[model samples]
Target: MMDIIDLKKKAAEIRIRLFQMIHNAKAGHTGGSLSNTDILTVLYYHTMRHNPQEPKWVERDRFIASKGHSVESLWCILADLGYFPKSELETFSQFGTRLIGHPNNKVPGIEMNTGALGHGLPISVGMALAGKRDHKDYRVFCLMGDGEQAEGSIWEAAMSASHYKLDNLVGIIDRNSLQISGNTENVMGLDPLDKKWEAFGWHVVSIDGNDIVSLMETFNSIPYTEGKPTLIIANTVKGKGVSFAENAIGWHHRVPSDEELALAIKELTEQIESLVSKEGQPHE
Candidate 1:
């Protein structure tokens, strides 16, 4: 396990990489990606058991980024984990690039091709059921957008997961208040989100999505129930780290101007520096 400080440093780096990739691509989903950075960092760098070299290793834990628009964060983390060269991150959303706007399974570390809203949970349920049937000990983690809860398929999948008693599965909702067009509540009310999942038989946990400590603690609490899946409703801001973008619906699919991108990068760099300095000593 990495020390908490080291993990935090990695999280900051992942955030910087996410901003750079999205800014460079000029056509990626920066808002959702930034909002989920800490969660993905915790999962890829610390919590989940995965083999970057053998992405399809059957015994490896599965992570499905259900809110596929958040692909930038996952792509950066995978590159940092050595699933692919970090240099390849430059091709994100470019013509002929495997790193499309949403995740594609062809990407070295991506487990599923997602981007279509509300598809990830059901697919993850299938994966979890397979693990149960085969008696595999591997766990499955699925990350969904808060707005995605509006989809009826998500509840359907939730019911199926409970019915199958998939204790090995974990669902994480990035409860960032804003979606593309407007606030999620105005677009489609999903208040009482936690209770809905709890009613569906999932063990629910809510946490501050951007706090690394809270994220680690929340993830560590998975598998809390013996016969049920766990659902973590992580309350978050839409564009998490960048001041200009945070919680602003305009950034949802908006391409940042050159000036905005430079500013965003600068802010992320400062965040990385702060975390690195607080680590007491540099990584060897």
Candidate 2:
């Protein structure tokens, strides 16, 4: 296992890089991307079994970004992991670039081309079922947005995953409670989120999405029960690290201006320093 300090450092670095990338592109989903950063961080930097050198390595665990507009954070993490060059991110949202605003199979580490809501979980269920049939030990993880739960297809997939008894599949919902329009409850009530998944026959775990320790502990406890898929509802702030954008609906698709970017950098930089100061502290 990698040291918690080192993992945190890598996550902070990815956050900084994504912030810069979005600011430069002036066109990327900011809120969900930021909300889900720590989730991506822990998975890519710590938990996942992936080889950047061989993205197609069949033995590797598969990751699918269901809420794919938040691809900026994933792209940054993948680049840092050496799946692709860091410089490739400079082409994000450019006229001719594979690194578009959503997850694309053209990208080496991306398992599927996903921007359409509610598709990732179903595909991941299939992946898990395939692994089961082939006697592979690899797990399939899919991350979805809570607001996306309003989509009927998502529930359908949930039912399918449970019916298959996909113990190898894990679902994570970025329950930031804010979507592109407004508060998720106001838009489409999904309260008692855990019960909803539980009724679908999944083992559910709720945790603070931004807390690295919480994320690590929760992920380590996966397959919470036998013959069931796991679903983690990660409660989080929409624009997590940025003070000005946190929980604000407009930030969902807004780009940070020069001044706002500087402020966000300052805030995140302070967080980086704080984490460094806790380097020697015992991690849970």
Give me the candidate number with maximum TM-score: 2
Clashing pairs in 1: none
Residues 160-227, candidate 1, lDDT per residue (tens digit)? Answer: 99999999999999999888778889999987888999999999998998888888887887799999
Q: Which residue pairs of candidate 2 clash?
A: none
Note the Cα lDDT for every prediction shown: 0.87, 0.90
TM-score of each: 0.95, 0.97
TM-score of 2: 0.97
Clash counts for the predictions, in order: 0, 0
lDDT of 2: 0.90
Error of 2 at 66 (Å): 0.6
What is the per-residue lDDT of model 2 for residues 1-284, given as tens digits with 9 covering 90 to 100?
Answer: 56778777776677778889999998999988989999999998778888999999999999999999999999998988898899999999998899999998998999999999999998999999999999999999999998899988899999999998999999999999998788899999998889999999999999999988899989888889999999999999888888888889999999889998888889888878988899878875
